[model samples]
Target: MNRTLIITGKGKVSATPDIVYIRFPILVNDVHYATAVKGLDGIVASLRNCITTNGINKNELKTSDFRVNTQTKWNDNTKEYEFSKFEAHHDLLLQLPFDTELINNTTNDIVKLERNIEFQISFGVKDSTIYKQLLIENAISDAKKSAAIIAHASDIKLKEILNINYSFSEITFRSDLNYSYDSCLMETNEKIMPDLNPDAIDVNESITITWRIEN
Candidate 1:
């Protein structure tokens, strides 16, 4: 029977985020379907203009979950459900460079475009492939060192690497947009800046190495 030793080592690399992701939505509601659709179109147009004026790339803007649906409310007085209104949602995602001033400026400008807009912010590294490779290498080195120490203590020789398994874990940043806002138009002068103190994101890699033990 062949004897083998298995060791698991973890390595982490801390790096500053080079990209910032900002996500928000414009919600429109009206008693009439046509009115709601028209309002949504106007709001989207205003938002696009705001993005462009801020010098943000058009390709960075993405719209999702654009839907129009009916809402029903319970009418206690009439003892029946009544069609309240049509609700439409336009979800927008923006990817920009990790400049604090630019993010704050763009966010402030975009918020001025509509009152029904709500948002969440997150930070991330634009290119993580290089960092990922470095972390894995460090993990492998750690595993080999550990195995060598254990073998030396046990008076055994490590012949060769039989197998290696590795995995990576990263942190995700997000906030749920479930707050209530007054249904009114936002004034252009009112600035909305959220405190965005981004810390170094840690990229962790864990590796398990199997080595054959020889006498």
Candidate 2:
């Protein structure tokens, strides 16, 4: 029989979000389909103009969804169905480089549209490839430190690494506990509620390693 020992270690590193994502939905409704489509086109044009004037790169702005729907209404007195109206809906997603001032200015400008809008904001690392590389290095360093500590306690030297396993914990954005706002206001504002506390986001990773012992 052979005797073996297993050790586990954890590492965490975090940095302020260097990128931002904004999602907004625009809705246009009218009695006639053509009118609704025209209204939607005008709104989209206005939004594009606002974004370009404010220095937001045109390539970063994109349409996420476009949909059209019709509604029917029932007349109680006549006991008949009546065609209500048709509406066009569009969802726009904007990817912005990390610039706090730009974000604030753009959001403020867009709010002037005053159309039916809903918004959501998220933050992330600017270069995901680099961030992932750093995470892996930290995990390995932590695993080595743990192994050394165990070897010292056991009064033995580590011979070789038998196996290494790594996993990353969930990564999530932190927001205010209870804060809600309409899309119009959200798009036009640069600062977000909860104030973006860096500590709130904790990036954790676990490493499980098996090391051979020198007898």
Candidate 3:
């Protein structure tokens, strides 16, 4: 006669993000192409100055993108194409230690200079070693609990762990609120909370283990 048992377990763990990455896009528009470009350049200069003057590390600032485009309009009365406007867009990327207060302060200053700016912030684990260690410990604990439960149900005693299988879990990156015109307007000048909520992020891992049983 042969006896077999199967069990499943789940492990959950949460961590606060240590690092933040943000991308800001500033858009400048005017009827004149050169004027729009100049405005965008000035805004960029102001951003750099603000960062440097505020004591941000120089290495943390980087130019992610720059572009200029022209829009045209057709006149209904005169069957002619009219130069509508020109737009200059610049994207700036920044990396820093997670500090909500500092970020909020910096954003308030930036928005005062330019109204047509949008931002996206990403949070993640800075050290791979810490993440791996936490995940492995949680997985093992979950496996042990599952093995114990199975052993008790089958009227047996768990003798030893035969095998362990682990797969890397994906790191979830998301924002508290979706970015929209109305949301962005409300965020300006609003005091950002100093401590971010861990519930805003979800971190999980799974482990499969085989244990020997004695009956």
Candidate 4:
């Protein structure tokens, strides 16, 4: 007969976020396709100008979503559906360092380019590849420690590990509150700033390890 000891171990590490992301969509609607495209081009150019003038890197800017669609709508006067109007959308995402002063100034400048443009801001870490490796090491260590403790109590020796499985939990780097460009511009005297401070994000890892047990 074969015998084995199975145990699951959990490890966690917390770190502060180092970067922030701002996402906005530029929507244009016009009766003619040419007009809609032209409007989109102008808004996109203005967006690029604002980002460049604020010292934000061009590589950090990304176009996430872009689409041009034509649809039909009811026309009471014509007594028939019309498909002359065109709608275009350009979604832009901006990444920048986590600086209160810089973010405030950049956002103010961006709003000046277009007041009606709606934007949302979120915070997160720039890269977690190294941190993930560290967490895996910690989790393996924890699994070994647990197996050793069990083996000692049973007066048995733990052999080579038969199987190992590890998974990471979902992490939240931003708070529940949403940042709005129009809302921030509403405040006259006070320079409105979003709640940029986010609590430490926990990097949680779990390992399910199986090892052979011997007498």
Candidate 5:
């Protein structure tokens, strides 16, 4: 009978993000759908112009999501929900390199456009191909090393790998500072700057290897 040795390995890789993503919300409300959409268009045009002045191409502004919904409100006389208006939202985004000067300049320009406007900033890597490759390599190496050690201790020989499986854990990144409109509108006397440091983003992966051993 052939015996098998199964070993699992864990790998973690860390890297600083090379890119920045900012999400801007453009909201409009009106009694008619067409009017609501028209209001959104006006805001979109203004946002495009704002980013273009900061050396960003107008095309770089992407629409993450756009949708219209009917809202309701309560009336004092009826004491029941009534139709409020149509609300349209355009979630716009911008991708920029991790440059301090560019970030400072671009965000400053965006804040001046409107006081109630809300935005979010997140740091991320441009390409995760290299990190993924490295993670797999490390996992494989770790499995081999562990299997070899166990086999040697047991006085057994490992001949061939019979199976290899990788877990489905997704790779994701997190941001340190996420700005909202209300918090951003604080008095200028008490100022807070967003963290510029590109914190280390960790990529973790695991693999299991089964090796056939001499009986």
Candidate 6:
């Protein structure tokens, strides 16, 4: 039988996020289907204008999902679900470079749309491939050093790399903020800046390597 040794190496890379992802959800409810959809369209138009004013390109704002569903309410008197209204949901996603001022400005403007807009903000890096490569480098170096130390201590020689295996894991830096204003429009002249500061995102990777040993 061939003698072999296996080692699992782990690595992590942490850095400040360079990109910001904003998700806007617009929900409109009306008894009439057509009215609900029309309301959604008008609300979307207002939303587009608000973000564009903050220097965000119209093209960057993409619709992730749009659907209309019939909502029903349970009635105790009828002992059955009653037709309530049609609900229209529009989910939009936008990616932009990380900027505290931009986040503050856009959110403040969204409130002025006079519609209840529930939005979320998250952080990410633009170049994921670069980060992954650096992560792999670190993992491989760690594995080699570990193998060398084991070989020296055991008085065994590492002949060759028998096998190398690596797998990718999602490196998510979710500083997601889910917030919404009351149905009432924000009526104020002074800007209400939120206290927002995100910590560095840590991306981790791991790999396993097998080395043939000679004794």
lDDT of 2: 0.70
TM-score per prediction, in order, is: 0.81, 0.70, 0.64, 0.81, 0.87, 0.88
lDDT of 5 by residue, 102-178 (tens): 87777766666653456778888888778888888998898899988999899999999999999746776555645
- lDDT by residue (54-77, candidate 3, tens digit) is 578756778899899888899998
Encode model 6's per-residue lDDT on 1-215: one tens digit a residue.
77999999887887677888878878888999999999988888888888889998888889999999999999999899999999999899888887888888987787656666667777787877776778888999999999999999999999889899996757665544433444344564435456766787787788899999998
lDDT of 4: 0.77
Supply the global lDDT for candidate 1.
0.76
Residue 202, candidate 3: how far off, in angstroms? 3.6
Clashing pairs in 2: 104-190, 107-187, 107-188, 108-188
Comparing 1 with 4 on lDDT, the higher-scoring candidate is 4
Residue 32 lDDT in model 1? 91
> How many backbone clashes can be found in candidate 1?
0
Span of ten consecutive residues with least summed lDDT in model 1: 174-183
63: Cα error in model 4, Å: 0.9
Task: Write candidate 2's Cα lDDT for 87-188 as tens digits.
Answer: 789888887875767776776677655554456666666555555566677877888898788889888888778888875655453322222347645544
Clashes of 6: 0
Best of the candidates, TM-score: 6
The TM-score of candidate 1 is 0.81
Better of 2 and 3 by TM-score: 2
lDDT of each: 0.76, 0.70, 0.68, 0.77, 0.81, 0.81
What residue runs in model 3 are displaced by over 4 Å at the alpha carbon? 1-4, 18-20, 27-42, 63-90, 121-125, 157-160, 172-200, 212-214
**Which order, best to worst by TM-score?**
6, 5, 4, 1, 2, 3
> Higher-lDDT candidate among 2 and 6?
6
